[model samples]
Target chain A: MADGPEEIGRLIGLMARLPGMGPRSARRAVLHLVKKRSQVLLPLAEAMKAVGESVRPCVACGNLATSDLCPICANPKRATGTLCVVADVADLWAMERSQAFQGRYHVLGGLLSALDAIGPDELGIPKLVARVTEEELTEIILALPATIDGQTTAHYIADALPELNVTSLAQGVPIGGELDFLDDGTISAALRARARV
Target chain B: MADGPEEIGRLIGLMARLPGMGPRSARRAVLHLVKKRSQVLLPLAEAMKAVGESVRPCVACGNLATSDLCPICANPKRATGTLCVVADVADLWAMERSQAFQGRYHVLGGLLSALDAIGPDELGIPKLVARVTEEELTEIILALPATIDGQTTAHYIADALPELNVTSLAQGVPIGGELDFLDDGTISAALRARARV
Candidate 1:
């Protein structure tokens, strides 16, 4: 028999499914939650419930939102002419965190994976093309992962949008990245894109 | 402003407070949850809500449960004569996972710590003594941690129940632990507690 009851075990099982957590860490996390039930666990549960019940994809930009349009998409002051395309909502959020891009986002949900049978339609690429003309977006900035699939997806989108200026995030050395620790591809990319001091 | 909406940010903040997770991991986890709303996120939210609403301390053993008595406490077949005393419910659960102990458990909640002002009374040492007599326990096995406070707590418990057969877990090299990787203190302890082949 397992420790605690069936519900506790179920909670652990669900928790273990999270990105970084495994069985051992999930158990420890659950134990910690049980210890601080009122302070941490209850609040987390409430927050999750609130998010789960209310949060939805923004119809215009595909970003998470409670209403029809995400806060960024709904903001009239945001750069409407420039659309930032990302593989996932996480990447969109990353861009938002940087505050470098004042434009709205277009989440592809995932990259066009041939192995996974994910095509342009599955990733809503058609919708993206439609948005370029619909929103009169002048530029489409592809802020995608530095992976083969991500590059492939970016190329496909660039080809599809012949009228619009489709660009991608710069491929170079990250700020404060150690040269010794970086891979050969990154080092070469950094050398190729070297700028004047 | 934080990534996504207020509720999304709240969820991320709450998840960041978990044992192994930091802000970065929390953001990743929240993003994953948002993406897998129907499959992983909602189910986890429901499970957490269920546990938060129902789970409480086992009055008998301090183990978490949906009822007054924990499953272990309610189980009549578990070794009633031998009560394994541990520092907390997590320790009790760890012992249960080992499957070596076919006995009941007594959770101390925490160890005696002068620095933290945690005394015997705070640890429910008196309640533990009451259970020893009430349950007619034959042997009291102190399965505390290998810390100074753990040792002090064990000593206090041993001294309190003079008439009872007080014992403790042996200090030795852990199973599957290599001697070369072990600390000097552990090596010395193993040597001191050397067993015959």
Candidate 2:
């Protein structure tokens, strides 16, 4: 296909590399940006440049931050006795959205994966352990996924911090999830952990 | 929901406004960019900025260009005598990808839509007429969409240029299209334009 200009073509090529974007969609996106140059394209360019220049992983919690600590980690009012361990910065954002956890987070960066060669050191498990004692944290909440790797990581953390109350999120039917649509494993787990009203 | 940072949030908001992207996909794309800052994010930002600063509509045809004339318009080998009229720059790009046409293009910017208040002046029809005489064009091919507005625009252009040999793209079953999956309108059009061969 004949591309427009070298710059436009380069923009489209880089955009196509983004997750969920292909060549076709990237072309459409570039066209959209070009058409709305002053409003969308210029602002997006500025925002991306600003983020690239300033944004970094929070030193304390691994969440995205402009400074050393993330907003959650820097907030003194947040519960210091509790730390929620999550798999990634995205998970930390999800937890913040829920507003159920008032404590700071410990981003693992990734789960323990034998196939991918990711171990405890890679996930900052030792640093997490250090934080537990340094901050005098009483409880560690494992809000990891239900995947095998997530479970393994949770178990490893639990074993490492035997003194603290280490617990994982409950596996049950999701809110507004129908029994017919739910998988067998979820249904069984829900039945086993049925709550009494 | 809590956002990462002000810069990150602005980026996500602008990205979500792009074609085929929503809040969820935008968030995912932003996270992916943040993780690959040096490799993907910085380059993409630079490309967008460059395109935004330089790219503009060609003076001759309305196709995207960094200069007065687009690559096709500036090329001496391209058949200036045979002009193809399309509804948008995207359509011009699609025709280029086909490699079927070796003519210059005149982007209408949009079709004649009474509801949308679009007219001949808005589509630069007068400018097109001037180009015909100035450039000494012999044939004008209307490679427009087979929609109501497209047909109306085609008819208007044909009426305006009665002296020139004006034609439109053939409407039939698409190449490699299944008969069973074809819409009734397409089937009828294909039957009506059946070739002797």
TM-scores for all predictions: 0.96, 0.97
Worst ten in a row by lDDT for model 1 chain B: B1-10
For model 1, how does the per-residue alpha-carbon lDDT over B1-197 read when each residue is reduced to its tens digit? 56888999999999999999999999899988887888988898788878888998889988888999988989988889999999987888889989999888888899999999999999999999999889899899999999999999999999999999999999988889988899998889889989899
Structure candidate 1, residue pairs in collision: none
lDDT for residue A107 in candidate 1, whole number 0-100: 93
Tens-digit lDDT track of model 2 for B54-128: 999999999999999999999998987899999999999999999999989999999999999999999999999
Q: A46-128 in candidate 2: lDDT tens per residue?
A: 99999999999999989999999888888989989999999988888888888899998999999999999999999999999
Model 1, range A118-157, lDDT digits (tens) per residue? 9999999999988888888899999999999999999999
CA displacement after TM-score superposition, residue B35 of candidate 1 (Å) = 1.7
Error of 1 at B155 (Å): 1.4
Ten residues in sequence with the least summed lDDT for candidate 2 chain A: A1-10
